[model samples]
Target chain A: MMAGSALRRLMAEYKQLTVNPPEGIIAGPINEDNFFEWEAFITGPEGTCFEGGIFPAKLVFPPDYPLSPPKMQFLCEMFHPNIYADGRVCISILHAPGDDPMGYETSAERWSPVQSVEKILLSVVSMLAEPNDESGANVDAAKMWREDREQFNKIAEEIVRKTLDLPPP
Target chain B: MADDASSSSGITGNTVENSINQDELIMKQQREIEKEISETIPLVGEIEELQTLEKEYNEDPIYLLKVKDLSSKYKSIRRTRPDGNCFFRAFSYAYLERLLTDKQEYDKFYEIAKNSKDILVALGFSQFTVEDFYETFMEVIQRVGEHAGSTPDLIETVRMELHDKFNKQGYSDYIVVYLRLITSGQLQTDQEFYQNFIEGPRTVTEFCRQEVEPMYKESDHIHIIALSNALKVCVRVKYMDRGEGSQVIAHDFPEGSTPLVHLLYRPGHYDILYA
Candidate 1:
């Protein structure tokens, strides 16, 4: 019963997106019958190093959604300190709601169902601008970030080049 | 000995006859119950069919004649032109009302709304009302486009644009027309966009029917009216207590409140002294 309501809301959200779409984001259900799983394509932010990158991601919402946040993971390879080897995004907004065990985030910083894909993308853009080095999803990248700033930038630049299919910057 | 054997044989034959008689009686009773059950189906179907036909026929010329008679009784009542602003303010509630009661009435009204020229002029002023809604909606889109990067900025921009759009007197007239569809239950929120815009007014009516009907059950009308009236008071209090931000401007909400409306209202939100 709870799942039914969440499904309905998810469908409504899907419908809203299809009608009055936000820029730089294209998302819909994987299948007409399945609103629980959505496939989203996001264009890399304009005027950023990651420009021209067309990243595909998946959003899987739990049955008790709106009360719980969806899990969003990049299907495409993304090499960054904040992105894990498994392609899971590490951001404050996507974290489980409430106090963080490692004392990193406040309750307000965590994910809420009210957080739409638009908000999440915006947060990711902000994250790209400023990475949280303290809690690194990729330890090697974090080490590079802390130890050798130039080398870290080089590696990020290389990844961005590969993403855009251009020569290394 | 012979006489005793004969009498026993005779008694066995009588016992078999008695058993057959009992079986026939049980079979007869079952048939009567079966017959009654069989007869009820056609009778019930006929009754339901008649009721349906009766309703459809009521929309005929005879029914219109009865309506004419009723109207003649109240003929002295002048068809006064409603204040444009008042009409705009009342649209949502009235639209919601019509949406719940009869879907067809809203459909008929929407059919008349297909011509943008007719909708614009026939509604309140000259043939320009539909054009006005289009412009206002476009303005909202343009405002949203301006704040492309941030979520907070997007919300703020949209709200500001809506505030401007609604403040204009032309929009007040449009709101009434929009509400007329809602109250008539012709428009549903879930209808496809092509149907809503391209098809006649019925689509808008359907949108109201689908979107807002579920929010308030028929039994809850009195409570909803009370709540709406109380909301006015809340807006007033917010204006007086908070100063600058609490004006009940169209489409603008209290700052930083979530985009979604709080469907569940507490008792205090509606506590008002009604005469």
Candidate 2:
């Protein structure tokens, strides 16, 4: 029953998105029949290693939505401190709702039903500019970032090149 | 005449008193039952009504809003129900299906769904693929509507077949293989071509490159970790946080960051990155 209602809500949001698009974010239907599954393109935030690079990703929504957040992963290989090798992202807003059980995060930082795609994309942009390395998903990447800033920049540049379909340096 | 009058009067009084007592007992019992019904009926009705609304307007947005209003109205009622919290999850699937089926007309549906962390994790499960969508649809109309189980194996089998093809292509990326299978239909020119294209490796690749490649490119290390973290956060936030141990440690780093160092902060302890 709620699923039907949530679906309708999603549809209404989709209608509005088509008419007015946000900057640095472009996304649409993955297929004609499925709205829950979409392909998205996010340009690397300006003045970042990912700048001018078009990154592709996927967003898959569950049947029982709004009560849950969508899972998004980049199809492109990226090197970042917060992302795991498996193509998963780690943003605070994407965290599940409520207090962190592990005593690692406060309740205020977790995900809520009110969080939107615009917010998520904006968070991603922020994530690129400044990653939260306190609890690292890609521990190695995080370590390298904290210990060796120069090497980290080189690796990131390689990723940017690859993302742009350029050969490795 | 005096003896007959006394006996008849006493007998009449006793019978009337007994009849009155019985009537009072019956009325009391009826009132209790009525009270119980009044309290429980609304909650059950809300659940039923929500389910009915889903069946009636599975794809209609306007009607769905009415259902949402009803949900809000009876928030307390649902809180009392055992599986009331599952409503968001249940609705997300229906909402997702609607969005997928009528993408052009219902783009906003995806946006709404994207808000829920739990829903996102469920959708990421391999079971919610496009092939499963078809299978689910057919099963619903098969006249034997057994709507109480997890996804059937038929769809999984197809995914397995597609996995074999991926191995042959020398592509080790699991996400790539998964996307190719789900979005296979988008590659076809018509409905007739969908079946053949989805099942065949050559066509699936062609379709994947055109449709899946661009999005795949955006999935950088940052996105991957964020996604994985989101999944964990959803589990922790939705399920574990309610448990005894509910703490999460999150660390963030800049892009192009590498994890290759050992930190020594204690007298004899150092944190080293494990390969």
Candidate 3:
């Protein structure tokens, strides 16, 4: 019964995303038959260390989609403060209130019924541009980001190049 | 020294893993408790005599006194699930149920509810999602409004229909969700005024996103005030707490309007009261 409404909302969001696709972001169901599992490709924000890279992530929505936030994880290799070593994205917007495993700030935007796929993807893009080291999912990456700017940028650039199948510079 | 460093790193990894596991375990237990509550209690229980409340507080003299005072003013109570959306759920249920007999009020509310979608959309809400919730909310309202002015027997049947629909998780939750959106829209529209009520540096919109909009986030006086103001429906909440009073304190939302809906508020939950 819950799936019925979740499917309808997912389809509506899918149509909205297609008709007016956000810049550098494309997302839809992986299989048209399954609205719960979506594949999203987000272009790294320009002028950031992740620039020029296209990152693909999977969003597995719960049966109560929109009520509960979807679980998002990158399919490719990712090295960022907020991205777990296994590529799971850990951001505030993907968690409901009081379900904070990362102890996100209270002011951070959270998952509400009004929040949509477009909003989550946009937040992800901004998260890539500026990682919040305070709630770091990758401690090593966060420490490097704080103490070794050059080394962090080099690793980010390598990941970016690897995303494009280019030889590491 | 090298062996010590490697062992220390391993222990750190183990600690992280253990903490993650503990968090997951706590979350799982919470879900289990929620599931038990859902299975045992209806989303909105049937109306019961106000005296039933006394049974729960048998050992406590203060609560018994307060319940006695409440029973004097209210004859019955209809409980809503203790889920965070109880305020919205109980308010909407009580209001709509009251509207069943009052055709005039139902018509007026119908117009307001009908036009609420546009208000939300104009306030920068995504039309696609808001419309879905609005449609479901309207459908339920229309269903309940159908038997207005009918015979007593028919009205009873319609009441049963209302009860059945409320029991269904889909319809009940959608109603809560739509009311929440309306509350959110109202807060954003009157951001300057509501901003003072919010603690910390969070803006009105930020508070709405974090507190008002999310499901399972408990409501406070701010929420009650915003929702009551938005719907133009007066609400009187009788706070039943362990404060040093024999009588339950009554505070009306918006401070001074005739209350069309009465609710019993206990710390974190709200239930409907019928006089």
> Highest lDDT, which number?
3
Between candidates 2 and 3, the lDDT winner: 3
**CAPRI docking class of candidate 2:** incorrect
Provide the overall lDDT of each model, using Cα atoms, as 2-decimal numbers.
Answer: 0.45, 0.44, 0.89
- DockQ, per model, reads 0.01, 0.01, 0.66
lDDT of 1 by residue, B50-87 (tens): 12323534756544343333233222111111221122
Instruction: Report model 1's chain A TM-score.
Output: 0.82
TM-score of chain A of 2: 0.88
iRMSD (1 decimal) for each model: 22.1, 19.9, 2.0
Which sections of candidate 2 miss by over 4 Å? A98-104, B1-275
lDDT of 3 by residue, B90-111 (tens): 9998898888888988998888
How well docked is model 3, in DockQ terms?
0.66
**lDDT for residue B268 in candidate 1, whole number 0-100:** 22
**Evaluation by lDDT, superior candidate among 1 and 3:** 3
Best by DockQ: 3
* Chain A alone, TM-score per model: 0.82, 0.88, 0.98
Q: Which ranking of candidates, highest DockQ first?
A: 3, 1, 2
